[model samples]
Target: MEPAQLTAAVVSIVNTLRIILEYMQNRPKRRQHEDDFDEDVDTDVPESTGCGNWEIVVAVGLVDTVERQFWARQTSTDWWDRIVLQVWDDAQWLQNFRMLRPLSWNTVSYFPLPKMRADLTVEKRVAIALWKLATPDCYRSVRNQFGVGKSTVGAAVIQVASAIIGVLLLRVVTLGNVQVIVDGFAAMGFLNCGGVIDGTHIPILAPDHLPNQYVNHKGYFSMVLQALVDHKGRFTNINVGWLGKVHDTCIFRNSGPFEQLQEGTYFPDQKITIVDVDMPIVILGDPAYPWLLWLMKPYTGSLDSSKEQFNYRLSKCRMVVECAFGCLKAHWRCLLTRSDLSTTNIPIVISACCVLRNICESKGKMFMAGWEVEANRWHLILSTQTPG
Candidate 1:
């Protein structure tokens, strides 16, 4: 063959191979996983990078900008769906119970990856946990149905409960012919009674030469929890931080109450005047309680008609606290067992649980007590006493 003809044939073959390679490279793969563009390449564009020589810089810039815009839109859509639209903007529930305070979205802003959107809201999460607490269920089951971790559910319970306790439950306003009922329970039969007084034998993996203080009067390793409940059955005050060995009266006296009495102060709001006098206020307790005028127990006088009647009403009202405690323990069976937790953390956990219980109670229908109006009456009475 002539040299010129041989060169021309080689050139043609090379061109054909190049065209086939470009077609194969640009051809669409499976369209399922990622977006695929058409195989066609504009003839005006240069071959090497499929970009025209003059358009390279602009193309790079445009690609970067488009990529950034795509990511930004995705992020905004995710936030709108999960936090704003799904959780906060639930119209029906929000209409009834609007958030008392603004949610700190900033706290979760650090979560870079978007959380999967779900049908559940924080309120729904809380309600589910409350339901579980009312009806015991395995943490695994709760987690599975809620599409949340057990730890997350527990945290939600604590967080919701804290909000209710801190914001929703009103403080004790006025004491109206106030009567108190107090009783003590024993874990292994030790006298405890300020409100729900009990000595729980928290069995620790026996420590080496543990302090005698850890051993209680029952000759067992235990701790004591003594608390005081208000007339409404709400735990108005708690007195913890006692070693298991401490007696109920001892724990109570050691608590802030004894000091307050010494200072001639009574009632939770120490500064508030009671019945026109800056005098100390009374607290109701059973005979087991120390002798204090402000602290009244059932009149031991023969269980006559008036006494029985008064006692009955007092017990009815006082039992609120007992019922509250019972409800708390029944739900968190972890509390019923000997907790291996340390002394300080125990009180904190208990307080957290109580606050959570109040949150649960707030969800259900709650009618104001008769004392609410009685309190208003006292406000008028007290206001009249003030010199205008």
Candidate 2:
């Protein structure tokens, strides 16, 4: 072998060794990067191959891009903390929540909501429920407005509604101030009238159980709200959750008011004589209800002049309940639309709306004129579509 040939081979071998050493030195950095992303990526990549390490790096980059996109899609501004908390105007508070802040505080004082989270205060829970009731917004929309999760908004609504039913239902809807109600009715030319009774249908989605039973003659799924309202447009008694297919008379017969009247314990023993017949303080009803001693119904077919006049007077006074129903659905727009809540929750929500309506009326909260216009428009459309 010549010296020149031996030197060339030796230099070539040294260059190869240096290249291998550099590759080994850079391997630890790549391994460290892989270890950082091992918990996030589920793929198993062999350490022996450069191709496998490249695949893991690509996967980690893709995951980071997806996370950034997801966070970008969320609203940047917190509505409750940034917008609602900054507003100090009472008008704005009422516009958003449908009641003044003071009344809302008073309501929260009656009952405490279940503590679901540290941020979900009693005031915020009540606001969430009231906003849901006053509008047709879905849970996601409400969640965005209140800066809460979608499930949290839904749970808040249920909790607040149950609270209202428990604490306010009996207190608001009862036969209190009986003489005042009777006097209000007498001014409308219906003497000895304690109140006017009527029934309205609250629209609902078809349930899985007994769907046919909830279908009314008007050809829609609903639940009946049999309510007795005073002349001042306040609900005195309400029987809710009956099937829409049930008749008003049937609901009346099974109601608490019915049992009270039958036991002769409803009124204060006040009687009035008309045509030599003594009648107790009676509630006026439409022809759909039965004529009881303590309940009066308008005359039916084949009416003479005297009977016609009697029916006109009775119906004139009965208009109060119709107006009350209109106001109830108008103020709480949730009752105007087909509710998406479960059947079990719908009754509680409806009863809560009734109680809230009575509270608003009793407290003299201003009802917007625009609400009535929209309500009448919706009612007309519903009437035409479901003629009975």
Residue 302 error for model 2, in Å?
A: 3.4
Clashing pairs in 1: 161-356, 223-244, 233-320, 233-321, 282-294, 283-294, 283-295
lDDT by residue (22-79, candidate 1, tens digit) is: 6556655523312332111112322344434433433334334232111111112243
The C-alpha lDDT values of all candidates are 0.44, 0.79
**Highest lDDT against the true fold, candidate:** 2
lDDT of 2 by residue, 298-372 (tens): 888898998888888898998888989988888888888778888889989999988988888878854766777
CA deviation > 4 Å runs, candidate 2: 1-77, 380-388
For candidate 1, the TM-score is 0.41
Q: Estimate TM-scores for all models.
A: 0.41, 0.79
- The local lDDT score (0 to 100) that residue 357 gets in candidate 1 is 47
| Candidate 1 to native Cα RMSD, angstroms | 19.7
Give the Cα error of residue 27 in candidate 2, in Å: 32
Pairs with steric clashes in candidate 2:
none
